[model samples]
Target: MAETSLEQIRSRVDADWNRIVELLKSKIALRSVSAEGITGDHMKRSAQFVADELRKVGVDAKVVQSANPDGTPGAWEVIGSRIVAPGAPTVLLYAHHDVQPVPDPTAWNTDPFVGTEIDGRLYGRGSADDGGGIAIHSGALAALGDELNVNVKVFIEGEEEMGSPSFIPFIEAHRDEFKSDVIIVADSGNWSADIPSLTTSLRGNTCVDVHVKVLDHPVHSGQYGGPILDANTIAAMLISSLYDANGDLAVPGIESQEPVGGLQRDLDESTVRADAGVIDSYTLAGTGSLAARMWTKPSLTVIGFDAHPVEGSFNVISPETTFRLSLRTAPGQRPEQAQEALAGFLESHAPFGAQVRVDRLENGMGWAMDPNAVATKDALEAMREAFGIEPINKGEGGSIPFIPELQRLFPDAQVLVTGPEDPKANAHSPNESISLSGLRHNVETEALLLAKLGR
Candidate 1:
């Protein structure tokens, strides 16, 4: 908050940027994919790698394997801490070490596990989604070195990509370890590589697998095509029922309205189109500003399907089909409420008396931060000082399920969600990346925030 009295921290981050990049590359080299059955020993090794890295910077770090709901020892989580004084306010830093499963590694321009620096961007699977987050905290801490003042605690969970299945139990078992005056979730993105942003709200999320059954067995298309609709066609009809002609959600109980708050910043249409990779001539859906459409409004997407492939010639009509829907909720709406409304609408809209069932329901709550919170002010000042530009405020369309839980667990702590990602990061997709300058500024911003809090 003071006039760049912490300029030394920024200089230090700049000096150590290359070393920080190397650390991040080492992290990206580990394939810690934690998606369901694909999880393996790489997760444990990744956690240990992060722990060892933290310890090297003078933080006390260790690895813990928490159990899932089924009572099996689950993924690894890294917990690290450093104490300056008993009187200093404690700050908890959060990031995930696990990455999403690479659907097709061959689709990447380089190896998904290798961090590639091209045109000033570091590209890799985990390079941005969270690997940059760990680098941000580590870079700041290393720069501060003997100047560090506040007590610091770090939680790097390995199951975030799998919706953090065991995070709640893990937190419940180690609650005291995370008690702090401030919490920084470094898992969100900036407005752009040039403009820094603070995520003021995050959309909640729900997912379900729907089964549409039209017949007991597959039938010949030539014989049954006249009167009966195949399960695939019927399933499409049911999904289309969820949206109106304008592409807004049509469910009755699900709320969809323009936001009246949250500093919904202006986003250029061309930038949105380019960032989302929307094809030319394809109009954007929903109403209101692009920011609100993404962050405050509800959206439904068919994430996966179980239909037949076109490779083999099929003269038969499929009798049954299953699809997965990922629904994002508005700020105030609960994931359960949205899932219920969606389920009801789907069952009622079953085409031609087809049997419809919604199964495998999963949900995570959303969150909104006060624009005038003290910690937000501190962070904004930190960003301004680091980037030398007025930072923008935005909300995340994606869900970090564990953030709301951390809020519920520590009601008094100020939670600041900021990170090194930008619109071009393309996290969770192939070719994910973070700009080198953005990463460096983020490290400076974090260091300034810590220094301000210490003061």
Candidate 2:
């Protein structure tokens, strides 16, 4: 095998830029949001589209069916393979095809399902989250073509946004097809537009619904204001107690670990404010370095509250209220332990002797990767060459549950968590976008990585 020039790889990706964008736009138009009770033709279509695109680049591809416990078809997973060099290490490229629902269409600058390019960015609900990821894989493989020296396996999942309910089963059913020595999980984020990053760790996650009841029914506030306690008030108080004045999670039994150390590029207050859409006057919560709090500590968020809307407010005390609590457990903490600790804390501290019920929703463990692995070293060098800057070693605050599962399945394999998402790419939200230039650079980086690992 000969040394592949970086210029040749860049030129190949640049030549196929239009085809890549067109492929992404076709996927974005599918509306394959895998929400609960939502299964349909679009999901299969999206998965098939991925397979067909890979086939166009001289790869063998197909859409595999995701199944239920009873062996019923649920969703689809696309798998593609290109074996250029026999006996070479197989690299599995992973991403997802399904996206999140557009909760509010009015908040978007363009149709959430229509991929739009503006100001050197591509905007759509899944544009950056994973549609860009799919393009990156396809473009990288296309760039290498027959010159690729490794056996490549591409796995695109279908239910990532819905927490991958059938992911483990799907993988278990097809374990042989997923065999690989290295996996590049292309569903994470970059530090910024120009700054590449290798995600070093991810936080565990759990959710529980807290229900409180203070009375049998609503009562007139005017007549019982002084004597009665409203369910909404008590629920709000209990939720508030989960965090201290400094914004730290006040729950006990959860554990924390040392943050991943390497790049000192701490997300500043201004960047946080802008990226999170926080008001200027509001102060950031928690303690320690922002990186530490984000990646190494437990954090709780109120996802939703089941209470009466302010629009139809009357002078009455509500009987019951329920709130959904989303907790991000620290890297070392167990989800079951965190769930128990949170539920117990809420039950023991019930305000004014109110009846409390906590229902656990979901749980996922965190993951950490060795920084000195051969594939990791190759990826870092490839990224530096592609982006012309040292890639930052960072950890994501969000959870990618299947990453740990991959590690457990192949303990000796190296897992590289890398993606093209930046701060402005509002994935899982309206008006999501990805930098076009950034996507090109990331594709080239992946191509170089595959070349190096093949050697």
Candidate 3:
């Protein structure tokens, strides 16, 4: 497509391979975990690190800061640009510098903050999620150098792991800077290690914390348990009502979309069981095709419950119970619609006239890309050529709010989602890691995509 040959690009990536790993390791060691008790300093440093790296690839980069959703504080957003092809379409590469927090450090085999390489996998928090993402983008740019076919704009967000509460505002402030004909989100995963994938759909997300109070004060369970309804029991009933006998979402009026891309009807149960660490005794929930259930249909999960701990041995039948419900909406379902439907279901299904308070926490819209769109077509061809295999068009169950937001902001731009994460990556879990070979292939794919699209 350009003067650079595929072999030359591959050699460049191979030669500077250690540098890419080192950069990712440095990022992982920075402790840029999503703002738990940590301040914005680490994320700021991480953004600066990305900016500096981009600058090394013949681009000028800068760090931008803003507020979080609560207006307390937010992470940094690193941006940079290089105009290799003067009049060619500008391609925006997106990756996040932030990462999910390690729930328990003791559970990890290695220090989650330190990037450790073992068995060709880089282990650490953020190493795969977006740190590997940052490396992929930078590695691609390094391969192209100043001869890139398209004008390049790199955006490494700092609050992705925190659900990107400040993302829309950041985009609003930098409207012109984010302008582009194509936007590639380097934050999703491939189908497998050797098999590449193009994420064509992402599930939307909506959640609420439901608190049910049965009595104003605690009552002796031994004396009055049978006569009064316990908040815990009512909460359990409400949660059970969320699904029908077949384990499908029982919420009325919730929307769902048919599966796209001729993807497989059902996901391999054996693969899921192995990857998810499901026990042999555990039964798979939900009805219908697994892929449809995962990527194109609504699913409800009771993430947490707050009640008197059994360890305390408090026989209190009275008081309150709270539970958090995480809902994954189908690709075409509107966020507002899903939220309204869920809220209505909970409000109407309060057990035995119990007081039910459903507090909506967050809702993000899902996105779907036209598989036959010009940009999507170009990406498929590039991936096939780069990976030497026909790429699989897949749908992801997770939500990336920025996808829909970016689509709204850049109506004409083609937004492509690709990354190095495989199902075995175990992102957000203890012992998270990335495949070195997969990372290299992803880098090759992006570099080739840029060249092909520009040409």
Instruction: Indicate the TM-score of model 1.
Output: 0.95
Task: For candidate 3, list the clashing residue pairs, or say none.
Answer: none
Q: What is the lDDT of residue 126 in candidate 3?
A: 88
Instruction: Give each model a TM-score.
Output: 0.95, 0.96, 0.96
Clash-forming residue pairs, model 1: none
- List residue ranges in candidate 2 displaced over 4 A: 36-38
Worst 10 residues of 3 by lDDT: 34-43
On TM-score, the stronger of 1 and 3 is 3
lDDT of 2 by residue, 26-114 (tens): 88898888883335778888888889998987779998788866676767888878877668999999999888898899999998889
lDDT of each: 0.87, 0.87, 0.85
